[model samples]
Target: MKPLLSIWIMLLCGIAGRSFAQTKTSTDTVVKPPVQLKTVHIVQYNFFKDSLAFREEYAKSLTFRRLKWYEVYGGLSVNINNLYRVTQFKKNKKKITFKHMLLNKEQEMFVSRVYTPSLVNKVTHLDGDSLQLFMQHYQPDYAFIKNASDYDLYLAIKKEYEAFMKTRDSIPVQP
Candidate 1:
């Protein structure tokens, strides 16, 4: 009976010692706080600034490209044709091509206005080469930006940046 009591006491002491050691090790470990991304307050889109930029681009294109009189006439015709549908004018490939060029320019301007570098930087907190890379990789389409509100654009950028960071973190480093 004395031997059995001694063995039981020894077992209890061993278990207690292990639990005490575990508690000490746990207390020694430092807990790190989770990382939080920065937030941006977006302002409303400025139509006045957008119009001025469009005018500047138009003038630059006209001056540098030295577009012919016929081309200008064709572009104007296409605009008029849109208001009052003319089947014959629509069939004209040259006029259609000129109109397409103007539309492309306008789309490019719209995208730039909506997705400005400053806006992206504000949302993503990225700059220099990283900023440039993000902009290049996640450039929004004109259709998407055209309908998106400032807040929508901001959320889209934030989501993209999070995904970008996740992928970047997952990539293994090589020596």
Candidate 2:
């Protein structure tokens, strides 16, 4: 390559590197909520969030090696389409495996009303059972998501808007 071109390339590389390093250090980072709720307080909170986003567009192809959130639980932000055809759930603890056709989708759960003072110690809640539950419930779904995408696998997250309507009469809400 010409010397002038090479010099210009070096200058551009240096500028790009410096700008990237500075931007990364200065960017604002958003923090997520600490996980672990024995019973979802406002059961509708997460259910509502996902219900709003369930239907953007399903990608026809998937590149994941495992299932995602949509496979086990339905939520608004998850894509649902082709996944219903081949989704499977393997419960390692119980030594039970479930396929889409085998899962008993007819689940009946009442929202457990928790009565706790807001100022109670946070320390008691952080322990083994909560961690296990967290792993049992959330880790696998994320594991699935980490491996898969819209390209091949397809599944729909339960839309939030309708979820409330479907369960509104069933679970009494606190005003």
Candidate 3:
């Protein structure tokens, strides 16, 4: 029984050590993703409800496809202040910060809401067009592109915007 218990303890510690070791980013070898990941940020005034609704729908829309999607929900222009600092979305954690400006005092108050997803799946239900639109448009005015053989992220953005605007009848697909 003592030998069996010792083996179990050793196995648990081995798992724990491996988990901690995996968090390090490897600089020597770089793994590039085949398809580019995209996100869009749109701003609006006097349409707080609409913006919130769109945020929720955006999340659902993103989940439509078999890829990871991200949506930000907030009131009016408030979310912009905090979400901007997020350089990258950490795996399963959703961090939300709320701030309110007080008219009487010269200080801003801060409140944060942190949620860990019960179950996180990087896949969802959006169509190809919508998915394309979501990734391409960083702002309503900004689009990002994935480079081809000459793959330039910026050029991809430019091409996608032009392609999105032109009519299919204007130019037919060339075989």
Candidate 4:
């Protein structure tokens, strides 16, 4: 029984010694190359000034490992946090809101107006208040231009010309 126990202990020691020797040779013979880090630029645009800016320290060189989903999510979160830093916000210690951060009065007004393609087309056509004053002086020229042979168009032009002349006549003449 004593000899058998002694043999078991000798086998365990031999296995442990072989493992240590293998680890040492593997570590010594295999040289790990120095890590090559790449630099990344973090850019942010200032909407009010219409300019872009970047930080030297924040855009430092980095070493990237495998691209994991969680790491990608974390990177996006960091980018959002950096973006928020550039914007102006009104906040107390208890609460914060981002409504006023990247917006000005003019931009807010523009955003408030829901501009559709039809509205843009109408604006391009010179309709509404803009054309009201012009229309008072001259009937829309397009009606006469497109249908030059029509007697009604000719009458309309004649009427507009007379009205414009009458308004001119009404103005007091400077001698």
- Models 1 onward score TM values of 0.45, 0.18, 0.15, 0.19
lDDT of 2 by residue, 1-175 (tens): 6999999999999999999888885347768799996975565445333423322221111112355545644565545553653454443212232222122221111011111112111312324443333222222233343365533112211232234335545553332
In candidate 2, position 122 carries an lDDT of 31
lDDT for each candidate structure: 0.74, 0.37, 0.38, 0.44
Q: What lDDT, from 0 to 1, does candidate 3 have?
A: 0.38
lDDT of 4 at 25: 55
* Candidate 3 wrongly placed segments (more than 4 Å): 26-175
Best by TM-score: 1
lDDT of 3 by residue, 1-175 (tens): 9999999999999999999788666765688779966977886533446445544755543333222223333544445534444434442233221111121111111000110011001121224554444333422221121112223433544454455456434533432
Could you say which candidate leads in lDDT? Answer: 1
> Candidate 1's C-alpha lDDT?
0.74
- Give Cα distance to truth, residue 16, candidate 1, Å: 99
* Candidate 1 C-alpha error for residue 65, in Å: 22
TM-score of 4: 0.19
Candidate 1 lDDT over 1-175, as tens digits, reads 9999999999999999999887795568898898998999999878668767766776644333322334434543545533334334544455556656876877787788769899998998999877777787778899889898889999999999988887865544432
Ranking by lDDT: 1, 4, 3, 2
Superior by lDDT: candidate 2 or candidate 3: 3
Candidates 1 and 3: which is better by lDDT? 1
